[model samples]
Target: MITSAGPEEGKSTTAANLAVVFAQQEKRVLLVDADLRKPTVHYTFNLANNLGLTTVLTKQRTLKESLRHTGIEDLSVLTSGPIPPNPAELIGSKAMKQFLQEAKEQFDIVIFDTPPTLAVTDAQILANLCEGILLVMYSAKSGIDEVNKAKELLLKANGKLLGAVLNHKKAQKEDYYYYGG
Candidate 1:
């Protein structure tokens, strides 16, 4: 699962990139937009969001029926269907666990793009289900305290922190210089 301390910190981008990378390596990858409140995976992949995670969870559609092919070999996406009034409840539902089990059995890698930890409880609810959580922090934009708080929240939810990724870091001139033999 990929999330951040706050919004606009590149969580979705990281999840999408990771899925693509795994797919390139010949692994079957499924990138799920678990951010029910504000989904962006459909937009990122240029896929229709008419039916997706929500539809599957509600039993309105099967997982296979809701999955959207990304046109990239071994890569599929399950976008957040529609904005629901109770996202947190839906995420913590038993159906969600069943969905995860089914997805894991089908894909080599199941990456979820979740909402920010501080912004909603959706990510925290999902933390317990996912094997690990990757927190994406915006360089120079995210405060140390906010990151720590996000970490604390995930840990409290029994989530295994898989370390963090620093995004949007401006490169300095010295960064371009490399030592070579």
Candidate 2:
């Protein structure tokens, strides 16, 4: 699962890129837009959002029936379908656990693009289900206090925090020169 302290911190972009990277290595990847409130995975992959995670979770459609194949070889996407009213409840449902089990059995990597930790409880709820969570933070824009609070929340939920991605860091010329070789 990939999320951030707050919105517009590159969570979705990071999740999508990670999925593509894993898929490029020949791993079967499924990038799920678990951000039910404001889903963007469908937009990112240019797929339809009529049937997706919500549909599968609600038993309105099977997982296989909702997964959309991205033209990017081994990548598939399950967009947040129809933005349910109770995103947090839906995410925390037993059906969600079943969905995760089914997804893990099918894909080599299942990346969930979740909402920001501070914005909603949905991320925290889903965090416990994920094996590892990656918190993406916008370098200058993200406050230390906010990041710390988000970290605390994830830990309290017993989520295994893999690490954090510091996005939009300006590269120093000297730093670039060191790696230019």
Candidate 3:
């Protein structure tokens, strides 16, 4: 699953929460911080990003070396290591392609926290790599115009859009669930 929307729309937070939800369901999930230009998945989880996706792509570190076990048993993360000068090029490069191939084999379900589709080609490119895309929208922040624009771009790229997620939703009593990890 590739989670994205416009900038600062809480993609990282949504991704983290999704991981938590998946964990609650007793599923092994790996979250890949693919937004190399401005990655926040690590920061949201309070993890270091000194060596992650960039390192793996530059060959300075292999995927295994960069993958961090989030300590949330059943969940792991791969941050965007060392911001690259050419983030778009790197994300669309052969290196990232190979990495996703290996990731698919390593994890039960891989979640890519991607850059906004409108801002860069990163999300569109990543949409191709992941099994499905989950576009996140902030209630007051993301306007219908922006959401529609993003939807058009993803659709043009043939992204497997699972659906749009409305974040910051007020949860009623029915929203709560309990399960051991």
For TM-score, the strongest prediction is: 2
Across 1-181, the per-residue lDDT of candidate 3 in tens digits comes to: 5555588887888788888789768787888788887788888788999988899898899988998887788888888888889988887889988988888788777887888888988888777666788899887788899898888888787788889888877766655654321
lDDT of each: 0.95, 0.95, 0.82
Q: How far is 21's C-alpha from truth in model 2 (Å)?
A: 0.2
**1-181: candidate 2 lDDT, tens digit per residue:** 9999999999999999999999999999999999999999999988899999999999999999999999999999999999999999999999999999999999999999999999899999988999999999999999999999999999999999999999999987788787765
Cα lDDT tens digits for candidate 1, 51-165: 9999999999999999999889999999999778889999999999999999999999999999999999999999999999999999999999999999999999999999999
Candidate 1: misplaced stretches above 4 Å?
179-181
Residue pairs in collision within model 1: none
Q: Give the residue spans of candidate 2 off by over 4 A.
A: none
Q: Model 3, residue 100: what's the lDDT?
A: 81
State model 1's lDDT.
Answer: 0.95
TM-score of 1: 0.97
What lDDT does model 2 reach? 0.95
Deviation from truth (RMSD, Å), model 2: 0.7
Candidate 2, number of clashes: 0
Sequence-dependent TM-score of model 2 = 0.98
Off by over 4 Å in 3: 170-181
